[model samples]
Target: MNDLPAFLLRKADEYNAPSFIPADPICVPHSFSKKQDIEIAGFFAAIFAWGNRTTIIGKTKELMALMGNSPHNFILHHKEKERERLLGFKHRTFTATDLLWFVQVLQQHYQRYDSLETAFFPTPVKAQEHAVKHGLIRLQQTFFSTPGAPMRTRKHLSSPERNSGCKRLNMFLRWMVRHDNSGVDFGLWKNIAPADLIMPIDLHVARVAKRFGLMERKLPDWQAAEELTAYFRTIDPEDPVRFDFALFGLGVLEKF
Candidate 1:
């Protein structure tokens, strides 16, 4: 495995390009330039990213259209009656009910803060290890903090506290925090360093990590995600999760 780092670097460079965007859910957010729009759009895209890539992109685009393609503005200013446009929307198990709650939470959040980064950090502090873990925990708490928050919607947002890998949320963080000239990841938020970002583990990432001897956990839980991220950090301490492009592309696109 001495050459594994070089192999990963090559693969990461191969896939982390603008060409990688069109067929993936990341395209949903790439369609927008506003920071909040990207955050809101990317959040939905990541959350809806299951089953099939085409379906995920389609559903996310439909959601954005329902919001009149100005997600941040729509979430902040749309009337209660305007929400009816989202009535029949459904992506896999995510229903209109879930979307409404999401809108409510986002509206409440954006009303107070200009960006979604604060929802994760809530305060300015120097970058620290385990920042993403704490941020995920805090986000789950704040998401469900509203009075009478639906129990059904809780399934949509996973937390490390629940032993979930929080794949979708971690993926969203990757979209928001990973900075590069590659133009794939947005790098819109600076509070969390890319180094501290945990690997967003799904079946694809898990399979690739195991094949490359990066992880051993049988279950792809939060521990497995952390284990894989820890391994990558050994190779590139400052920007470990950049290897995600390699692992995910190998598993999903190359079927390795």
Candidate 2:
């Protein structure tokens, strides 16, 4: 695995795994010892999570100000010393749903730590309202929430599209964990094993995994995720997602 180019591998891993930055506002610590600090950091992360670290280059300030003015949107203590780096919209890319989804999270957090002081929060259950509001979450007819709901997948499916979804979701999760983009303080919730996790099947990851013989099914879809995950389960049932890096690395480094 290390045979792949270091920088390329790093980029692949950067996109594949969670690198929780400290400045991210959504990275709720497992222990709420310093809750406010963690939540603020988590916020910073989710904001930049849309694509990559480079994607959300400098959008912290705008979000911070939005938090300040939108009382219902954000909660921060007046007395707390804020990070100056988080002062302005260094480079903002706005989507109404993104802001709305963020506030919904705050509404839940406030139920406990009434003040805007930083507090650790775990990944809250994804609400349908937020999905519909921001129109980000995917809606597939076959994607029901029932236990082991079946989704459609033809055998001919290939990479890029099939595995791309996981890329997006994983990127989002990374944003959910860090305070900044640097992984300086790994969040408390970093041990999450992505069992029964949905595959964000984009063409890139799927084609790559298939080329490495990790996936037998040519079609990349929900069934593909399940089939591939079953094989990985045997390798390390406790945390099968580890294969994602190896598989993704194959594609990024063009090893396959």
User: Residues 13-86, candidate 1, lDDT per residue (tens digit)?
Assistant: 99999999999999999999898999999999999988799999999999999999999999999998999999
lDDT on C-alpha atoms for all candidate structures = 0.91, 0.41
Q: Give the range where candidate 2 is weakest over 10 consecutive residues by summed lDDT.
A: 133-142
For model 2, how does the per-residue alpha-carbon lDDT over 52-98 read when each residue is reduced to its tens digit? 44444345434544556334334433322432323433334444433
Models 1 onward score TM values of 0.97, 0.45
Off by over 4 Å in 2: 1-53, 57-94, 112-167, 170-187, 190-201, 216-220, 253-256
Candidate 1 similarity to native, TM-score: 0.97
Error of model 1, residue 147, in angstroms: 1.7
State how far residue 128 of model 1 sits from its true place (Å). Answer: 2.3
- Who wins the TM-score comparison? 1
- Pairs clashing in candidate 1? none
